[model samples]
Target: MNKIFIIEDDVRIREELSTFLNRYGYESLFSINFENIIEEALKEKPSIILLDINLPYFDGYYICREIRKHSDVPIIVVTSRDSDMDELMSINLGADDFITKPYNTQILLARISSILKRVYGVSRGEILEYRGIIYNMAMSEVTFNNNSLELTKNESRILNILINNNGKIVSRDEIMKTLWQEAEFVDDNTLTVNVNRLRRKLEDLGAINYIQTKRGQGYILI
Candidate 1:
């Protein structure tokens, strides 16, 4: 079952949300210690976070930004403040999605399910090994022959797609589509820059010529 962390100040709303989620087959963890909301949420490490803007000690925006610093867990802002600025701020703070107060339980559940499917629901783990390098998804780094190469988010993602596909070629467009969800946004050159950077990183880790470009085709991990 998917675990959900709820961080709403209103006891009634929190409890109701928990009960609703539980009824829909999700394990719910509520925020009790508002003073240590971030700490507790980190410890819980739910599959997704349901955060309210009107938190006690720190607003959800602050908490969301702090959480983004450590983990990429999907966060959905649940708040009664249904202003355009509030929604914009939520996105600016790295919220995966936003919902207004008096939200329909079904809609909330749908949003949660959609985000999780797009993120954690995918087949990913702490580590992925391809050829000689072990891609640590958690750390966004690849290790080869005892040497570790740290990767930027885009670099890691590009390598991961190629590695995951293995023998088959992975098109640049395909990579862009997959990464657009996590990236701030990218253009054609951004992908080229990331791939070039990834090539250098791989070479540094002794995987020279590992990622091959097929000229007009795409890239393949050999």
Candidate 2:
């Protein structure tokens, strides 16, 4: 069973989410120790995390940033802060997804399910190779010229789509729809951020010029 780590400080909300997720066959784990949340999360190593922006001691942004420094565990920022800046900051800090407070339970559940599947549902030893660069889906890392680098959930997903459609231009709309089934909830800018980040990673991995912009069409793996 996939373990979901809940990081909301509200006892009632936490309990509700835990119960709801449990009904969906997910193992829910949480800690009331708000101050040491980062430590708790890293130690537990859950499949995914539901993090609230507001907390007792350290905020979710700090916890998220700290966690990304150590692990690529998928984190969904669940908060009442629905401002564009808040969502952008969460995404910039490496959150896999974001949902506001008083959100529809079904939508939240769907987002959780989507992220978990993208992050951890790949078959063992599954990989895609293009121009000598290898993307290992199961490991969420890319190997090129004997160098290996881990990828965040979103980065890996974006790369996966590009590699599968090699030599073709994939429109932004299609990529966004594939990444988040409900594209309306996702900001158009978010996709740009993820694609740019992925491009940088690829460049660092010595796959420079592998992904090229089609100038209004979208991106293509050349």
Candidate 3:
């Protein structure tokens, strides 16, 4: 079954979309926790995401970018902002398609079906493989040399951030935010613990110490 993660603050729109998606044989998951939108998205591993531009804790653009880091799951932006620039900006941020608000439900469903077919149906699978490791961004499942490896939520988040960067530096603050969202009571030690767990997993897989710590800088997937 395909899961569709809907991240819109408007309760009315959320309900309508969820209902429509269910009718189409999709499992639609809606989020009320604005602060944890991205975290929920990662956990759900939806087949496609319907994101709104304006959100409570953080905007949809940030969430889209965060999701892009670890998964290539199709992101079809469904927002109220209809300006040409808004559409262009969304595309630049890696959105697969952008549909402005006040749109027909049928049209929205059509766009979603199209994106899903293009990304999942046309392609053979949803997981991205690198160095014999399969990273299933949708299910957040990872397998090393064909064996399923268990990973904590935080550990999966770390891998998602690093793999998305693809040899780029991801700052510690960014990682912290991705994990903790708007919680004001996050401790540095918590992040430290997550990173340690992720490193151990990678080491067990014989992956080079590719996740490097830049003293005072941030972590990077080298």
Go through the candidates in order and give each one's C-alpha lDDT.
Answer: 0.82, 0.85, 0.77
Tens-digit per-residue lDDT, 1-222, candidate 2: 778899998999999999987866678999998888899987898989999998999999999999999999999999999999999999999999999988756556556655765777732234566786778666688877667788998889889999889999999889998999888899988989998998888889798999888878889999
lDDT of 1 at 111: 68
lDDT of 3 at 156: 80
Q: Write the per-residue lDDT of candidate 3 for residues 78-183, one digit (tens) a residue.
A: 8888989988988898999999878755445546655776777732224444554556554566666445567778888888788778677888889988988953
Q: Residue 153: error of model 3 in Å?
A: 48
Stretches of model 2 off by over 4 angstroms after superposition: 122-222
lDDT of 1 at 12: 92
Instruction: Give the higher-TM-score candidate: 1 or 3.
Output: 1
TM-score of each: 0.55, 0.55, 0.54
* CA RMSD, predictions in order: 16.6, 15.9, 17.0
Model 3: CA > 4 A from native: 122-222
> On a 0 to 100 scale, what is the lDDT of residue 2 in model 2?
79
Q: Against the true structure, whose lDDT is highest? A: 2
Error of 3 at 201 (Å): 60
Q: Pick the candidate with the highest TM-score.
A: 2
Q: Candidate 1, residues 1-222: lDDT per residue as tens digits?
A: 688999998989888888977866679998679899998998988999999988788888899999999999999999999999999999998999999978655456556766766786642233566666777665677777667778999888888788779999988778888889643466678888888999998898798899888887788999
